[model samples]
Target chain A: MEEIKDTFLHPVVPLDFQNNYRVGAYLQRYLDGFKEKKILGAKCSQCGRVVVPPRKYCGACNLVMEEFTELPQEGTLENFTVGHVNLEKGQWKRADAPYVIGMVRLDGAANAMLARLNVSPADARAGMKVKAVWKDQVEGEHADLDCFEPA
Target chain B: MRNVGIIGIGYTPVFVSKRKDVSIVEMISEAVDAGLKNTGLAPEDIDAYVFGNMATFEGVNMPHLWATEHMHARGKPIMRFATGGTIGMAAFHGAYYHVASGMADIAMAVTYEKHSEGDAQVGLMGIITPELMAMLSAGIDVTGQSGMGAIGGGSAGGISFQASSYLHRSGAGIEHIDAIAAMERRNAAKNPYAHLKDPEATAEKIAQTPMVSWPIRFGHICPTTDGATVCILASEEKAAKIADKVAWVLGVANCASDATTANLIDSQITDPAEQLPAIMASKKACERAGIEDPKKEIDYVEIYNGFAHQTLMYLEKVGMCEVGEAHKLLEAGELEMNGRCPVNASGGVVSTNSIGTSALNRVTECALQIMGQAGEHQVEKEVHKAMAHGWGGLMQYCTITILGDKPKKL
Candidate 1:
């Protein structure tokens, strides 16, 4: 066997890809409500449950959720986490500051929505009252519903 | 449907972080050769092939198309599945269905993962990429306050919430999590194929590890391993003719729930710790298998526990024990290799996680125990029946398979 050198001959190939995803009719309408500073939930006629970030189907009832309803701004924090690190793509790095992320059950909606909380990590508790804060300048996109703050 | 049995199982020579000497196809061929060697069967005997792996983990798409010759699957009907960590079991069940449905006399389920070849985290994030893109299009930065932007908590962060909830509801402490991790690591030490072996692992040692999240330590996580696992399934007649000892498949079932809580992004009104899908899938499988009481019938178990806490959590969810009783069982030494009901005698996914093989390993491990061919790691008890579990697909999907020493009574 011969000793092989020039191990540096390994080549680097960078593959870049961009894709366009259809927001679909359900989410498209939900985002449209953001323009009017309103949050929407789809109601399932069979189960009578309201799902936020509106979708076309209710998994529990297996019914078409075509009935759109407006949800209240206030909610109860169902669950949360205090992140000490940040996950980027596939790498983990220490965060400059720990932040609180909460799962909130908005009023009048049967399902919960996830959003960052504007509170200290120590103060973040499950079942705490919170209200949504918007970006002021609505762009008809997801960011329009900014982080939730303690109510 | 016809009766199906596992006739043979094969694993790579080693489960490690890397296989630098061989290419992806070359590494998988090792297991194929081992399977053929074990059952004295040839490539021609296998009528079909069912392959699975976490796609994009190795930077390759539809790898079976490129490695047909290496897998000895040339001119054979091939099917593939990709269900996150449960792909292995999913593919195994695919082969089981093929043989059970009388489509083929014999079929092979091959599953593997070479995490060393690509970035695992990136591959994991790919599951929520579309969600991330939607978040990005909304002008929300990818690494903003919601962690990895919207729905970027990754596996560990979300699992922490699960672990915390389990601790709260079960009245188990973080110490129990440490104990479970330590126990599985110690179990891994006895298995040759396991990747992370720690015979002397203790709760104190596990607790010493850095805390990644509340109630979860670094030691509680599964390692990314490079390895392959293959199992050969056959019809009852074929199994009896080809192999002397067979692990009969009494039942097989899989169920999936909402991917919200599993993704750690926007959780619906569901609780991650509830794990309703696991309860439903296991119950449905037990019913199909005619098991009147799983707690009394199952002699051994192999749970797809990527994290140590899941071993305890799933044990209860699968009806192996009453709710909030798995930890108590653990503290009583009932989950050890020589316990009343031994669990993860082959360590578990917590010990050797080749993401694709993790789920399938549970079934194969249980089969080995039922066949009495597990060698040193075999449970001391006379194993009559065992249950193998696989949990994946954003943690909402579950696959349950029941294996028994005797064939199912038709």
Candidate 2:
């Protein structure tokens, strides 16, 4: 049998939506700390592991992390990636420049935070010391901690 | 628990990037029909239906509500699951439990994904988009900036970090990743149902493909295919009367780690490459299946490798080999279809991923191998037992199932 094509109708759909979300208390506190140039971490009373972008419950210890602690700005780069492309709302395009993104483990924290690294692809390496570069005028948002740079 | 076995399996006519000739419902009905045809069972024989897919990808939430009539599930209890990539196996396990617990005599697990219908990565962005928008509204300058959000690199960028970490810990190079990708592409060429087929694929050729991230090349990634997979599972009594051959369910297990595993920009409490959940889940499954030594007893493996490097990484994490031995196995051509323990004889998820069907394909492919029905892609060795793995939920959740030629001794 010969293959058939162009038998079905093609319809283009364009959907636009607006959504509202609650950042919750834990994240609210974390964002609030960003306004003061302070990085807030939730400390699990039982495990003593500090979690950044703090949440209410400790995933490991299964206990409430009511004690909020301030973390040092510097940490070690645990792992990272260098991407040559940008994904914008699911669309892919060539990046103007290759970018380095890393996961940084702050001092006294058991978990690491993910952030963009202001380092060249050739220079970024695991175990390198890095520090958070916060926005000068923070508006209590996620991007308040702009990115990380070599300490 | 009572014994349960896979009585039949069905796949869409083809697995490709588009199915423009048919509507979504029409495409899925084909797989349902195929299952009925293969098993020689009427729709009434199916006691229940377990459906799964990443609903957000197609802009269709709660698809089962609309798919009920098409699946011949009217008036039947239909359970739905959505756990990222693992939804396939998750749904299949749900069916297995339904039968093994004596609630249903027979059940059908159906999974599919129509990537051509909507933006695949866009659906994945739901996890971090709200926060990104909040950051944008607050005047945080992420525009044209690096690490804008988790969606910046989609899944590949973060996966590169995991790949690099795996290389660091395993002492394996990018060349090893290239070789494994070439191997799977070659394997896919033999799979009649696979989406990506490159029989002449080689490590050098794979290296020539453009890199998406530092260590991830376009050739190393999975294709966003449109397809569906269905497997009919039955209780021991029903299975005996339905088919001459069956793949018995020896054990099934799932493990979930903290969300921090996939945190690339946040503090990661656990390394993605460490894959503690895969280790825990596979070990628990092996224990339940009475498998003391996987390297010796398991005849082959079907790992949920959305990226080629995961095959080597998961082989180690699942304890099929020591922490650093999977690359050695690859170097020795031990992961080939003709090798001592064939891995991903179906070409694996790296070759064809419909997202929803990805994990379930692992189960169905292993069942096909055990039943000697895989045809061109079947391994040469005598198969007694095989393992199927699924990974989902920001790389922290994993499901493992052991399928064997014989039922577990109860």
Candidate 3:
């Protein structure tokens, strides 16, 4: 059907784009850590809040997360969900959508992270174990192994 | 919160074609002009403005000023807000605050998405990067939304997370999901102003359409609409001078959670869309309006159902029912226009929407119904009170507004 539609009308201008979603204003520290196959977290001295994936400040205390530390990419999976719907035009289908996306709590990390799971949503549970599959540094930033899979 | 009411509302029909009749600037003017006209007010009547189109799409660093200037409302207090799909209602809340706070006698909120200038899907996917394009695309055919301007991003980022939770927790099947898509498509057919108003829509047709992503068919997604919507909010004194009927903003609230942001490498970032912000807002608005149990007290609702999943989420978010019971509400037919509480009587954003403009359309439909002006979709019961919920930026930016027939002393 797309082929049929493309025959009569075609796009002339190049619609190519880029991945401009960066970590933060000074994203280098975060990007540099991920590039070295390590997870980073930020700690607030005033409130003693630990933030995973790190942050410039502790949201609660409204103060800077002064401590910078590398935490293990290991945490218990909290209340998990397997989303079956893959949206194109905001419609749902029986097939074609991506696998389940789950929330995970990293070891010693304050806030949980949301990403993809390699395991089937059906088999997924709240306490299931999972791990990140970081992309090869040579592949550059964001190309980091699409998402986390079963450990 | 002070009492605020929507005096007038106007939304342009979402068109598929690149309207050559008017420039983008003029297109926005048409909507703002109509909204002002509805209130019998001029440009100067508005003391402030809020524009809610994601900046990524406009390529305009400042959308608020552009819309304000186009509406001839420059030099007034203005704010520009963007949240993936929720910006429209988010901006609506911005203008609502001014009137509710006595800061302004009248205010206007304008939102538009002109995808004709570029590809919507590719533009939407600009959040990540080239090699990771396949991530957002996943296994779906995101063609229509490919170049559509990216608003507050939602299911676009996390595919299986929300849907899986909804189905798993509710014990719903693909048939139920298909039912949702069919219902909205059928509803859209009734809406002549809708983008894809095909009355012939059937579950088999939706099933046959190429599955863009799992559980989400082409019919389930919102149209890549190009249009604008403007809503004029006025204080009690000014509202009294407007049209015959005034839909008071009984309840209005906005809230957010801390753990919304996520690492691309991380899986399932808590799906913050589930936050009770919209419900909280509804409670606040209900308090001011003095109406309890919106299900029993309200007569009509226009929820943000950009995706069928959101309708489910919003049902719970607006406190219409218990969380995860949205699918059940659809199954029970509780959301039908004739049911206990009618929802999406205008066919909803799932049927006709320009994300930024869609939410205000919800507010407008309520005012029209209160004014007894809804041409075909008016409810049998006199619309004494109505509610409108708008979910912006991944459902992260939630705004709930309640409108009523009479102004109550708070």
Give the candidate number with the greatest DockQ: 3
Tens digit per residue, CA lDDT, model 1, B191-299: 9999999999999999999987777788999999999999999999999999999999999899877554433223344566888878998999999899988999999
lDDT string for model 2 (B189-285, tens) is 9998899989999999999999888788888899899999899999999888989999999989998765533422333344658888899999999
Candidate 1 chain A lDDT trough over 10 residues, lowest sum: A8-17
Candidate 2: which docking quality band? incorrect
- Pick by DockQ: 1 or 3, better one: 3
Error of 1 at B223 (Å): 0.4
Two-chain DockQ for each candidate model? 0.01, 0.01, 0.02
Clashing pairs in 1: none
In candidate 3, which residue ranges exceed 4 Å CA deviation? A1-151, B126-157, B259-273, B323-325
The fnat of each candidate, in order, is: 0.00, 0.00, 0.02
Give Cα distance to truth, residue B276, candidate 2, Å: 0.6
- Tell me the tens digit of each residue's lDDT in model 3 across B1-410: 56667777776654553554455665776687677776678676678887878666545557666445567665677777776666777787888878878888888888887756545555544433321333233432223344322212324434434555566665666666666667767666666556766667666676776555556666667776778888888788777767567777766666554323221222344443445566677788777678878767888878887766667666776777776677777888776656676677677887776666777778877777787777676766778888888765533456777778887677
Chain B: TM-scores of all predictions: 0.95, 0.95, 0.85
- Alpha-carbon runs more than 4 Å astray in model 2: A1-151, B128-144, B261-268
Model 1, B57: alpha-carbon shift in Å? Answer: 1.1
Q: Which of candidates 2 and 3 is the stronger one according to lDDT?
A: 2
Tens digits of lDDT, candidate 2, A1-151? 9888875322112234432223456677888998899999989899888989776556454345789999999999999999999999999999999999888999888888989999999999999999999888899999889999999
